[model samples]
Target: MLVHTAWNDLPGSVRRAVVARTGPVRSVTPAGAGATCRLAATLQTGSGVVFVKGILVGDRLAWTLRNEIRVNPHLPGIAPRLLWHVEQDGWLVAGFEHVAGRHADLRPGSADLSAVAAVLAGLAAAPRPGLPVRPFAARWSGLIDSWHVAGSTLAHTDMSRRNWLIGDGGARLVDWATPAVGPAWLDTAFTVVRLVRYGHSPADAEGWAGQIPAFSAASGESLTRFAGALADMWQRQQDRAPAAHRGLLVDAARAWCRYRSGRSAVLMSG
Candidate 1:
């Protein structure tokens, strides 16, 4: 588990570098360690509120911060703006336009579900930008075929509720620290798993995702294989870490895998 660095605990030079860009922080509320961020906080600055997230420059996963900076320009309304970045005293921090909003509700009958689907559809139709990012397959060890990273557009692999904020701008994604070059439809598929985790049945989750053109157009065989792969991966995660939250995902993944496997069997029989 990555420990969070308190805002006050940061070095004087590092804090100075951030304040220079944010314009004197009146109050700092620690945002906790996001995905791979070692330090995250929301600051009430003279100019406005800014969300800053960063990691130690010498940390093993510091590359994620670089990827966030590289991909920020490509995502417009779908993501918060990366106003600026600073590196000092072995720390790399990036300030983003703070978006005040609540985490999306993906439960059955939630209005946010449709909005989330719309966002995924728009992302799928977006033009692929040229960047030095690695393929999605590069992140996983032996899950290449399961990951299906051979598509043109980018993908936001992490689909947590907190990642999708519903605020003044409908929904805006945050923490693009580990985006990948893969099938845009894959992103929607990930959301389907989240929907199931949030109380939607496998069929309902699929139906909800089917509204998005990408998910609707995805190959059925690929979806089945992806479901099975996710179940196996999550099961392994549960065994290794035994985290309570991950255990919940393990159940969700297995449920989807069973549903998809049954669908595949029905299709073959017909």
Candidate 2:
């Protein structure tokens, strides 16, 4: 099997350092990835399983790993267990008990939607210790603004089904670098759009959005406004992305626009 590492294109020293720290590094298997390269590896020393996230070695990456560790602890059962860090190879190696399941295509009747929503609710309800209570409100408000700015909520900005891992009883969310403390709706909206873009029915997207209270609490801003602004931002982001990713973004933006516009009309009619 092909083992994927972030610095696989780099020198042996880098790979070696990661191997030495983790274990024998039996094989580097690409695990969950989309915009970033992720690898799952088995250690020769019986180290079990380890995930290596490639990052340019620096304070920024350091801050990211630190944030992962800090947030993981507070998230409890909601997040993956952060095992260890390997700084030498410019890879952040974390060991999590491998979850057994595949990515949900996010269909209307799919079981994955509820699992994903549950995780989102848990994340929205989680405490940030020193992080302010209204930590998500400000960014959400900005997104609501016509200016169309990204929110600061510790949201799993990339709530793609790709990041959600399904196991026996529940699903766990991975990838923490993009955490934003914005409106809870922002996160849910992103997921809902992703599902809709992937061909899930409008009702499914609405169903998922309806299940979350954090969506309302964190985004005291008008839901329609936030949805419209996010769709616009998503479009701009799509423009800058490579053609491949742009397609996904385009689909997602359309779904977002459709839902937001429909919601607005409904409110006016009521």
TM-score on alpha carbons, each prediction: 0.94, 0.75
Report the C-alpha lDDT of model 2 over 1-270, residue by residue, as the tens digit: 123444356457767676666667665565434343334443333477655554445434445545665566555676667766655555555555455666765766677778888887777666544453234444456555533333444566777676777888688887665565654466777777777777776566766777888665543235556556767666777756776866776766776677667766787799
- lDDT by residue (1-270, candidate 1, tens digit) is 468999889999999988888788899999788657889899999889998888998888999889889999999989999999999989999999899999999899998877788789999999887776667666664864734546777888989898899986698877787788777788998888988999999999999888899889888888887888888888877866648889888888899999999999999999
For every candidate structure, what is the RMSD over all alpha carbons to the true structure, in angstroms? 1.7, 4.6
